[model samples]
Target: MIYFDKVSKVYPPSMVALQDISFTVEPKEFVSLIGQSGGGKTTLLKLLLAEEKPTEGTIFFESVNVNDFPRSKLPELRRRIGVVFQEFRLLSNKTTFENVAFAMEASGRTPEEINRDVPHVLELVDLVEKANHFPHELSGGERQRVAIARAIINQPDVILADEPTGNLDPLNTWEIIRILKKINELGTTIILATHNKSIIDSLGRRVITLEKGKIVRDDKEGRYVL
Candidate 1:
């Protein structure tokens, strides 16, 4: 569903974030990107998300050349992708339910659809009971689950979670991983980027290791070996 072909991303000041990285993620696959800091994993994601352009080569979402996508269609493309960050980017003033609802409203979804889908997604993340709570009123784990709920509310085809468990304790980390596993089981392609060795090792899935803007290894049922 996603392909990066000889893609290189360079920032100003001659900084190369990714160097000719190439990979293909089949539909419904759960892939882990394990790498040290500044290793181009996030850079590759930015390129795929259309937040940044590749300096060389190309990126494709399905059969469409994402690098060449028309500017006007970016919102449509983003609607197909769900992103979760280490820091849950919830609105401070909005309740958990509203936070997820706002995402759908931004995409011009109808009120009927938003009302129907938001509750279902919150339930999926086990946050239905906390829907009325504000960000500060919830625990860190609950907040992250709200973020995940918001990401999946639109039923996006791919979920990009970068360091999702970075801020949680071991127990909460496991909770988040389980939630992600559930989402993957529902057939959403999942791409997880992290430096956490233990979490990656416990997953025992396809692991890709990156170093200094290049991928060094790609394996199935892999362990995190930095």
Candidate 2:
């Protein structure tokens, strides 16, 4: 459902985030992007989310050239994809339920639809009981779960999570992985960028390794070789 053709991203002067990266992710696939810091894993996610444009080449989402997506149509493009950053960008002032509800509201969903979908997403992430709590009131893992809920509240076609377990302990890390696996099984295409070797090893799915903005390895059932 996603394709990158000769994609290269270079910042002003010469900071290359991705170089000649080309790949295709079929619909419903679970893929892990594994690499060390500065390998451009997060940069790839930003490109896919259209947070930044490619300095050269093109990005296509389900055959639509995302690189050329109109500015006014960004929301439509974003609605099809969900993004979760390592920082768990939840609004501190909003309750967990409201945070997820806010996503639905942005999509112009009706109140009835928001009420119906918000709880379902929270339940999916196992944050149903904590829906009334604010970000500070919840533990780190719970807060990330809320972030995941908000990301998926719209039933997005692709889920992009960048270093989702960056701040969690081992137990919480596994919990987040389990939820991601469940979401994948439910048919949401999952693309996770992580530096955690054990998680990628255990996942045993397609893994793409990037180094200095270039993909050095692409393997099925891959290991963390970097």
Candidate 3:
């Protein structure tokens, strides 16, 4: 449902975040992006989300050119995609349930819809019992689960997860991965950008490796070979 065609992003001066990168992610597919620090994985995700424009080439979400979207249309584009970050970007004052509900609220969802969907998404992430807890009250894994719950609450078509397990222990990491896999199984396209070899290796999914801003490998059932 996403396509990148010869896309490149360059910051001021000589900084190149991505160089001539191209790939396609089909609906309901689970894809892994693996690369070292500053290797352009995050830049690729940003371009897809239209947080940054490509310096060259184009990015397409379904058939619409993401970079061509006007400012007013950004919310509409973003609503089709969910994002999970390494740091649990939850509001400190908001409870877990409220954090998940906030996305819907921002999108102008009705109170009735928020009430109905928040609980269901929390259950999907196995955080139903902790819904009333704040981010600090939960463990690292629980916090990340809350983040995931929030991301999926709106049922976005694609979930772009950037190092969602980076801060967790092995057990917690696995737990997060399991939740992501479950979401993928339930028909959400997942684009996971991570540096964890063990997670990538174990996933055995489509692996796209970048080296110095270029795609070096694109393999189906690929292992983490950096």
Candidate 4:
């Protein structure tokens, strides 16, 4: 469903963030991107999202060349993808339910659809009882779960999770990973970029390792070696 072909991203002067990176993610697949900091894992995700332009080669989402798309078309492309961040990027003012509803609202979904889907997604993340709670009232794990619910509310075909569990404890990290796996089982393609070796080692899923701006290994049912 997604392909990166000979893609390279060169920053100003001579800093190369990604060098000739190439990979494909099929539908409903759970793929882990494991690398140390500044290994181009995040840069590759940005290039695919058209947030950063690649200096060479192309990225394809299905048949369309992502690099060739105009900026106006980016929102349309992004709606097909969802993103979760290391810090749970929740609204300080909004409650848990409101936070998730905000995404559907931004998508131009009606109040009726928002009401129906928001609760269901909150339930998926086991946050329905705390739907009225503010981000400050929640634990780090709860806040992150709310973030995940918000990301999946629109039913994006692919989820780009960048260090989603970085701020959590071990049990919470496992909780987040379990939820991600559940989401994958429900048929969404998952591309997880993480720094946690224990999480990666336990996954037993396809892992693509990046090092020094290049792919060093690609394995099926892989363990954490770095």
Residues 90-176 of candidate 2 have per-residue lDDT tens digits of: 999999999999888999999999888888888888888988999999999999999888888888999999999999999999999
* Residues 66-173 of candidate 1: C-alpha lDDT, one tens digit per residue: 977888999889989999988988999999999999889989999999989999889888888998999999998999999999889888999999899888998899
Deviation (Å) of 103 in candidate 3: 0.8
RMSD values for the candidates in order, in angstroms, are 1.0, 0.8, 0.9, 1.0
lDDT to native, each model: 0.92, 0.92, 0.93, 0.93
lDDT of 3 at 5: 96
For all predicted structures, in order, the TM-scores are: 0.97, 0.98, 0.98, 0.97
Backbone clash tally (model 3): 0
- Provide the global lDDT of candidate 4 against the true structure: 0.93
Residue pairs with clashing backbones, model 2? none
Say which candidate scores most in lDDT. Answer: 3
Global lDDT of model 2: 0.92
Kindly list the per-residue Cα lDDT of model 3 for residues 40-135, writing each as its tens digit: 999999989989999999998999999889989899888889999999899999999999999999899999999899999888889899989999
Between candidates 2 and 4, the TM-score winner: 2
Task: Determine the C-alpha RMSD for candidate 3 after optimal superposition of all C-alphas.
Answer: 0.9
Off by over 4 Å in 2: none
| Superior candidate under lDDT, 2 versus 4 | 4
Worst 10 residues of 3 by lDDT: 118-127
